[model samples]
Target: ARRRLYPKPFPGIPYNKVSANRIAGDLPELIPVIKATNEYSTSMFAISTQRLRLPLAQDPREIEDILVRRGREFDRAPMSIKTLKNFFPYSFMGKYNTPEVKEQKRIWADAFGADFLRKVAAPSIYNATLDLADGRPFEVVEDLHNATLDAIWVALVGEEAGITRHEIKKFLQSQRDASDGGRRDPGPPPRGYLLRREVDYVSEMIAKNSSSGIPVLAQKLAAYLPRHRQFRRTVDTEIGLVMRKAVDRFQRLELGRLEAGENDTCMMDLVLRRKVLEAKKLGRPLMDPTKDKVLLDDTFLMMFASYPTAQTELRAALKVAFPHPTTPSVDELLGADIPYLDAACEESLRLAGVAKGNLRQTVVDTHIMGHFVPKGAEIFMNYHVDHAPYPVDEEKRSASSQAAGAKLAAREGISRGDVSRDLGSFEPRRWLVKDEKTGQEVFDAYALPQLAFGGGYRGCSGRKLAVMEFRTVVALLVLNLEFLELPEEMKTLKASETIFRLPDMPFASLRAL
Candidate 1:
């Protein structure tokens, strides 16, 4: 039992030998690192002897190969699926590279494709951000969340969710009611405000599942607790809400209430249209979102994952925006001609590091960096290697890994360039270069390592949408308002380890331009 409980390392990789003795495994050593950095990736080698024998890879080349090149050998890790599946079983995040998942990805790709983003989503995001220009003091994170949620809601549901607007109006009315109209406090609701039903549901789900150390177990045992019971109720209610919306949309299209011809208004409409076409092609009945678990789950996942990622990136972008003495105008921003804005957004993604790392499971006997890894072993690729200074013991690496690294190093003209310098600094200009032929500065994404969204075929599906939202919000905010320097108390870089690394206190003061 003891031998089974405390296992040894998988022979060819580096791990803390001391960690193999304890039943808790490397958790004792890992806790401090997580508390200090709020990230799972570390400068130290990973030590795990718990349920899964895990290995951490820090070298960029090895990490890139695992994510991009060796798909047949590695799949999304079970640890990740275990946590995410409890909350989103039908979402792609919880599934392997199955045919159904591929189809879902295709649908999601179309939903967030270039045409949909530029034509259908951009205007909604723009209008949503316009609400942020109110010179009143607001919590940066909360307000950004509201705006992002509203934007995504419009894109998903084809109506003004009005979350941001509703909150702003509620705050103003409460101020009037409280006779505190003269005093504009620069924090969250001084007392507290009622959360929208949808916001409450989403918040509770993320908070419960992401914060728990053992999400799957917690979910299974949740029925015994009151708060967990409430969570279950909330989840059911939200599911019902989603089902009703889907049914309404399908009924409208069927009854001819909604003008046909590719109801290009929102994702829900687009999905209904696609299903209708597919049904026609197959000579079958239309699939209902209420009955189709994939449709329902993916729709909910769209709303769940959309805003948080953008909100985290936006907070980071706000920190780096308008660093220059002169800021650009709204016209310049809207024209999409500014390379600095693009650079700043990319820099923010790197600095913020919302997704600290990615996890993959070995599907068969394989070697990472020349180290032998067996099937079902978990490999974690930390993004810190992209920017942070970490020790690399070349002697510990496998011969094949060394040879690959040498080959990569010898490649002419392939370099990180400015990104290799000032590893800790936020210099957006590092991503900009002069186009020799045009004599104009353009954003060069390849100049730096971009693992923020991961890579390969399974990379983040929402990368385009996230970047578009970040750029739009950052550009508009920089163009129309001045972000006052945050006080020391409000400027802590420490973040909570949630679904994303959310800044604990993302507060800011804005002055309308």
Candidate 2:
């Protein structure tokens, strides 16, 4: 059995090794492992000490076959839930499997329905992109990240949170610290600190205005303050308080709008409606603003989750994918197909696997791929490992070759495989195909790839919104300015494993066309 599983000594090197007693860690670069696992099963691997597991699938079909068809059989693997607990203690309130989580998911999912998504999200994204590209050589990651944050905030909250690069950087630092059990140097001040400060600033403004009997004037003044130092105190305290107040204010505003028959189509408004409708459907009383902090938590959590991931991914994508000197301009990208951009974003996500590894604790003794997985065993699926290369049909190979050729041509004097192999390697076009006879297009023609949002009944509820945001950001970047690689000396940016793969530092430089 050992010989069968360890046949021929796996050739690909492991990405990260920590004393032989632990699970061998794989990095994004180890695509071959993912490819091999997708193609064949090997029981020699043990994800945890007590249970031996099989190789993962690389193609989407196999992923779907397992996740979709037999989803109940497999469960979400355990991951570091500590960070989530610390940051969002109130929502799931640190409980992973709770009624609150289910309720929050249901409310958020309902709020992001199709019509609300297209109208509110799409235009907001377009405008935000244009605003970011208003004649600046801004770092693509920073700019793109801010754009996504602003767009999501506007869509969901009917207001912008005034996101800034420094604030985002600090927020990311806090999340990273939380993930490592608060171990690493406590990098930069906690972002919660900054949010608390902002809340104080707004509250003071509101208080001052209230005394003057002019609430509107105070709001206008607070809105005008710069994002940085807008609040004079810590972010957590200040922002938390303000959000509490805003939730109340928005609820009342929504009521007035409804009374007046106003169709204010924003995320906050949509969620407010859903909450009421759901309350009625379940035969429960309407959400009490004062008691049930669920709505407030849901509103803020959505903003928080949506912002950092989008920012981190956007930055990582630009840092790795853009060619130096003469990258594809943002304007050129905007005109491209939404699906193609979506594919690029998906490819980036697969390569990065932002959430890193997912963990599951066994509920009952079960066998997976001929290996015994004992009850209570902890299992992990390294998403990065599941994204390796596998057998590709003629069409896929051709598309990959074309994308490679295009990169080579763009480099002009550089060696064929230098930049092409290390960074800027993935080609979105590799995922597309055109019919030879009629020249019609085919979407995801390759066998099912391991790129679904996730698996099971718990699959991503906000997939539609996420796709729209990704497509909009990519298109805007492609259209506004070309994505160029920074000079060789400045090209050593690394992905920091925070809540997502954020740049270790601001991406070197992005030149505007």
Candidate 3:
């Protein structure tokens, strides 16, 4: 069966290459051929002719059923530890699902739950949008990224990182440099490079202080005493000073709120309360300062993990949805409704395809798609294949048809030629109210797209928070400013795929209308 379906591998298909460059630039053309091949191999085995060795899934549901329902049978896919280690050295400090880590995750999940997200996080996100759109033409992606990062930072740290627009540009450059082999280039690096170097320096200092009897301050000073270390030391010292200030600010603010009978609802406050409760239950001494340090570090890591992905998705959504416009208007956006924005977000996530694939190592020999996947054999869920567009079910087709008829009737006076042929193609109206047919209401499809947040246990824990952030920022942007196209030189942007998606270049020269 495997041999018959793909007897002759399609050669010279430029879209089959799975490199980042190809996936971003050439995916649309390659999708149809891949879908056809996938359908042919549904009841049979087949080998991909693509250089990337990508196996096509028949549909998104097939991948979800296996990954979500049969999750225990598979584990995280293999990653180059050497590369990961460089970025996250502390990952090896403990087991992946240690009790401590689980507890920490639980706290974060609880704090970022639906209610808290709507209340505490949403307002800040809304405000960030206002701040970014204060009467200037700015790169939508860059502005939105910084705003999202700022909001998330405030939620996590209880204090702002004081992120400036100039700093955002600098940080993006540094991130690009780090990802694109720029770190290896000879010469003095940018300030963002120096900032990371300082972080590494301080991290070493903290580790030395932990193990030895030396005080943290003394260790920090010693590390920075050398002449070449002056600049790096200043960076490290400033960060340390800021962190301490943030900690102090949190303590006073939280204590004051408690005194005034305010609820302990913020994430940082929750972490502190949990630590206090556990200490009392265990009869352990209170160590507020030490606990604060732990919370700060974890918060920093979470911010790093989260912000870029939000930014990338926001940028991609805007790029696809408003290809020729500066930005969509607020009234235009709100009238479209939540479902349209949700679909747009889902589509961007699908196309962006952050994280190469879902990693799962088989725990036992399993017959997946009739292939004898051996016990201990590694399996990867190719998200790209899963998200590729395909035929819809009957129910979906009916809903879509109803929506189309309604839309046509509403615009009765307009020519049919002016109507859109592809309703599924980034049409926010598809999610809005259906057209009225003879005073009868026609509805759009309810089958929501399955991208952005993965479903099931291992799905992104912060999905609610992410959605709130995305919606607030997008809505605010549409309300306050127009999203004009950046200058051509600033338009050729690239994406850097880490564990999450980030832009490889800044989208500058966007003017606010």
TM-score (all chains, Cα) for each model: 0.81, 0.59, 0.57
Q: Compared to the true structure, candidate 1 yields what TM-score? A: 0.81
- Write the candidate numbers in order of decreasing lDDT: 1, 2, 3
Worst 10-residue lDDT window, candidate 2? 39-48
- lDDT winner between candidates 1 and 2: 1
How much is the lDDT of residue 166 in candidate 1?
A: 67
> What is the lDDT, from 0 to 100, of the residue 319 in candidate 2?
46
lDDT of 3 at 458: 56
Q: Please give, for residues 197-305, the per-residue lDDT of candidate 2 as tens digits.
A: 4333433443344233233454455454565233322334433454455445444544445443245456666666555545555678765543455555555556555
Compared with the true structure, all predictions reach lDDT values of 0.65, 0.47, 0.47
RMSD (CA, Å), candidate 1 to true, equals 5.7
Best to worst by TM-score, what's the order?
A: 1, 2, 3
The runs of at least 3 residues in candidate 2 whose Cα sits more than 4 Å from the true structure, single-residue gaps closed, are 1-66, 77-83, 90-100, 164-262, 277-287, 308-339, 385-424, 445-448, 489-493, 504-511
Top candidate when judged by TM-score against the true structure? 1
TM-score-superior candidate, 1 or 3 = 1
Better of 1 and 3 by lDDT: 1
